[model samples]
Structures are given as structure tokens and as C-alpha cells.
Target: MPNIVTLAEAKLFIRVLDDDEDTTIETMIAAATDAVCDVAQAWDGTGEPPARLKLAILSRVAIMFDTRNSLEPGIGEDRLLLPLRTVEL
Candidate 1:
């Protein structure tokens, strides 16, 4: 099965995407999706995503990662998004 995504991995991914504005949204979504997928795959050592939550958080993951205002509604004050809480120094 897939492996669980760690905080380090997530932070590193956010860093990598910080440099590429064009692909940030897609990359972040893929990273989050891969993270969940990784966890699912490793859960049973089956190397596959769990079929239980197929269309889970992966759907809105892109929107949460979309820092470029690519979406119309734009990032809101929802607690569902982590980026909204990150404080820059």
C-alpha cells in the first residue's frame, strides 16, 4: 500500500513549489494526493491507494494549494487550508 506523508515531506514540497509559480497549484495537489496515496499504499503493503475514500480530500486539495488566485473564490478563511495559517517571517 501507500505510505503516510510526513510533516517534513509536506514542508519540503511547499518549499519546492515556492519557486515555480506556474506549476505550484498542480504540484501541491499532486503532493497532497500522493501523500494520502502513500499512506493508503503502505497501510497494507499493497502499494495501492485505498478504494474506500477514492474522491476524498484530493478534490479540494488543489484549491487549498492554489496561492496564485487561480480559482475564482480565492483562498478563504477556512480552517481546512493550512496555508492560511502559516505565518511568514
Candidate 2:
């Protein structure tokens, strides 16, 4: 439910992106999808949860990110993107 990357995975992922710089769009897209899938799998184990539960989890992450980082107050779809900047892992 919560979108998260392991600290090691985040470090490795960023390193690869930084080093490659020219990773294909498809590869980037796959990596994004894999990140989400990793969260979903951990949340439900079966790899799926009810849509409402998924949304609630996502909402919690957004709220936590904004509160924890002091990235502009309030919720907006764009806040989801901001978490990438605020999150440590």
C-alpha cells in the first residue's frame, strides 16, 4: 500500500540512473512500475488490495511526506511527485 523503496534499492536505483543517464524510456517506466509493484506486493502479499485501501495508503504517504518535510502544505496530486524529493529512501 505504502510506496517505498528499500534504502539499498534506492541507492542502487539512483546510482544506475545517474551513471547511465541515457537509460531508455521503457526501462525507466519499468523501473517505476516495479517500484509500485514492490509496494503492492508487500502490502497485500497476493499483490493486490481493494482499490480503496490502495488509495488510502497512498494518501497517507502523501500526508506524511508533506508533514515530515515541510514541502508546501495541503494535498494535491502533485504532492505525490514531491515525495520523491523529500523521501530519504
Candidate 3:
């Protein structure tokens, strides 16, 4: 959870506005964190993981929340994650 955004921050970003959905939001945050790390291809980002990555997580969580069952198509997140991606030959 070192580079992941906190529950409070995610709630605010997604405008949860209440504790009723706290558990669900927490789940989304955890999953989103892992997903972002996978996309970045490295969880060992030095210092902070960068704002774009954090925002990408928030956007993903929002998509998860809105879709209810799965993330929406056309998330267009390559820009947020590609720069941080570690290329492998």
C-alpha cells in the first residue's frame, strides 16, 4: 500500500459521501492499486509513484463503481501508465 492512494482520498475523489459503501470502496481501492502496479510493471517505484498513476487509479475505481460489474470500455489509460511501464525486450 506504499504507493496506493488512501481510502479517504479515494472516497473524496469518487465522492462516496458516506460510510455505507466504505467496504466496497476499500475493495475497489485495493484492486485498483494492484491493477495499476501490474500495468506499470513495477511496484517498486522509488519515492512517490507519481500523480498520474494515482489519478489513473482513481479513474479506474470510478469506472468500477459506475459499471457495478466491470470496468467500462475505452478507459484510454495508456498515457497514465505507459510512461511508467518498464519495457522488456
Candidate 4:
């Protein structure tokens, strides 16, 4: 599956330099994408993903990367889990 955000973009967001962790970063991106899709209840696996979704994914990836082995890596009050908007009739 194509990622909403590129590895380079994610790396830059997380302030990671060098290609040493490319594979790990890719995995993080995939996980983050899934998380965003799950929360948003959207994503057809094609087309440009929303900026908010991308930002949410990037934020998650950064948190995961920074707190790798911690027993409980806290993510407070995740705004990414906001309910999807609905059209009013």
C-alpha cells in the first residue's frame, strides 16, 4: 500500500537524519497510516489523504520512534481520534 506521507517527510517531521532507520521509519509510517484510517473511518488506499490525517500519522510516528521500548508511551488526549464529520440534512 502507498503511504499518505513519504519516508522523507516522516523523517523530517521526526527530525531524524541519515538513512540508517529508513526501514523502521517506513514501518512506522505504515502503522501510522493504518491508525489514521482506522480513526477517520476513511481511506480507499488511493488519492491524496487529508492534511490533518497526515499530521496525525506523523505525530504518532514521532511518538513511537522517540519512545521505542517504554512500557507505556503516553499519548495524551489524541485529537486524531475525533469523530468523522457528518453532513446534516
Candidate 1 wrong stretches, greater than 4 Å: 1-22, 42-53, 57-63, 66-89
Candidate 3: where are CA atoms >4 Å away?
1-3, 72-74
Backbone clashes in candidate 4 total: 0
**Ten residues in sequence with the least summed lDDT for candidate 4:** 70-79
Q: Among these predicted structures, which one has the highest lDDT?
A: 3
- TM value for model 4: 0.75
Selected candidate, larger lDDT, 1 vs 3: 3
Model 1, position 12: C-alpha lDDT score: 52
**Candidates in order: C-alpha RMSD to true structure:** 12.2, 12.5, 1.8, 3.9
Candidate closer to the true structure by lDDT (higher is better), 1 or 4: 4
Clashing pairs in 3: none
TM-score, structure 1 vs. true:
0.30
Output the lDDT of residue 80, model 1.
34
Q: What does candidate 4's lDDT look like per residue over 1-89, in tens digits? A: 56688999999999988999999989888877776676666555577776777788888788889988642322641554454332346
Which is superior by lDDT, 2 or 4?
4
The lDDT values for all models are 0.40, 0.38, 0.80, 0.72
Runs in model 4 with CA error above 4 Å? 43-46, 70-77, 83-89
